[model samples]
Target: MFSPRACEGDTNPVLIPFLLAAAAAAAAPPAAMRLDYFHTGDAREERFALDAVVREGPWPGPPDRRLDDTGLGRYQFEVRDAKSGEPLYSRGFASIYGEWETTPEARDRARGFQESVRFPEPEALVTVTIKKRDARGVFQPAWSVTVDPAGPAVDRRPPPAIKVWAVMKNGEPADKVDLLLLGDGYTVAEMDKWHRDAKRLADTLFAVSPFREHRARFNVWAADTPSEESGVSRPSDGVYRRTALGTTYDAFGSERY
Candidate 1:
């Protein structure tokens, strides 16, 4: 139930193919474990509190590439075996909080953002450590928590009941890069249009270079929850509508976000 919104640029058609190729190469990945939490902070300091942990379907990437050697984000999370201390998995990613903390608003008041981190489901107890970049661009421990995969509190409920169809199927999900296109603000009556647009976006992605050459190496899927009303909320224009994705313009005081 705690589905995190795909970040900006995640739905970018051109970026999908490349991201799939790089991130997912596993032949038989494990189920995905999602750790949802509240990231609260001001410009001076921040804190993290556990919200819920859930199983989020089969893991879609290569198992061997669990450690994220790519230092690309403002934050990094690692999952380590509790008994052995050996790292089991790790990934670097950015959150909305990581961006908001830099804004001027953060200087005056603390803000909280719902954030989530996904990794392969571990077989045993593990310690999850979250790290943030320091002023010197070095990663420093921010928070750590222990998680037992089989703990009663871990939510094992199946992912939301929504239709997921492949726009393009290349190979087994574990062997190929998988990209999910989530549609927002589309109405039930516009479901067909959502499908068409999803495919059109995929076509646009494939038309671009390098993706054009390796189209067969990627798989694209689309899922949507129709909104009660069409289009997204734009309070600036005095047009407000609730949508499944809860997406709106003027994020962080910027219209483009």
Candidate 2:
């Protein structure tokens, strides 16, 4: 979730034994906090509602880099101390709902989608806000919710019991910039193939320019779950299979997308 972008590292069935952490601070990085919520609306209007708060793995980001100054993505989220209203952490991210609302279909129908934002856990109650871009591409607050990191409502359960293993482990996840390769659409019978694929991708990444030169700064990890069927749902060809990560080839009605 830290800078590699959410499409890969964030939402995947893990192999099981992974603990990706971050660069050192005076103290250990805070535990990662995930806020799950609903994104619902039509093209004309949108809304957000809290779904859940989760205590995930240890924080795997640069401790000093608490604020995102890059100005990237169509949406942004900010975590602020509830009392003083001082910003604690912030990040810019793009979401499926952000893309869906642009499609012609959204204009005719109202729909709801699930979305989540992750940040370093805070000590006291904090207000998390989601913002969206306006006509001039300026971010405006879309929703805000207050959360207590240690509250009973936070889900502290461990991740799902999928098998997790290191593709290349230089050190513990907390010590290095970790990259995760998630295998989607592979069945239990094809786990071996998934492992191979993950290895190939990780190796290729490290073999390239910037990654190769600074390879020691990174660790590659991987995981996936068994799907009932093989392959993904490719609607363009009428080929459909139920997979753990239900990623389809013909997204947004475009085969190339």
- Among the numbered candidates, top TM-score falls to 1
Clash pairs of candidate 2?
A: 15-163, 15-164, 15-223, 16-163, 16-164, 21-173, 21-174
Candidate 2 similarity to native, TM-score: 0.81
> Tens digits of per-residue lDDT for model 1 on 1-257?
32344445437565578778777764346789999999998999999999999987888777668899999899999999999999988889988898898889999999998999988999999999999999899999999999999999999987778999999998987678899999889999999999999999999999999999999999999997899889998878887888999888888788878
Q: Estimate each model's TM-score.
A: 0.84, 0.81
lDDT of 2: 0.87
Q: Give the alpha carbon lDDT tens digit for every residue of 1-257 in model 2.
A: 44444336656434222323222344676899999999999899999999999999888887777899999999999999999999999999999898888899898998999988889999999999999989899999999999998899999999888777899988766568888777888988999999999998888888989999988888888877788898888888889989898878977787677
Clashing pairs in 1: 26-62
Off by over 4 Å in 1: 1-29
Model 1 collision count: 1
Pick the lDDT winner: 1
Q: After superposition, how far is residue 33 of candidate 1 from its true place, in Å?
A: 1.2
lDDT of 1: 0.89
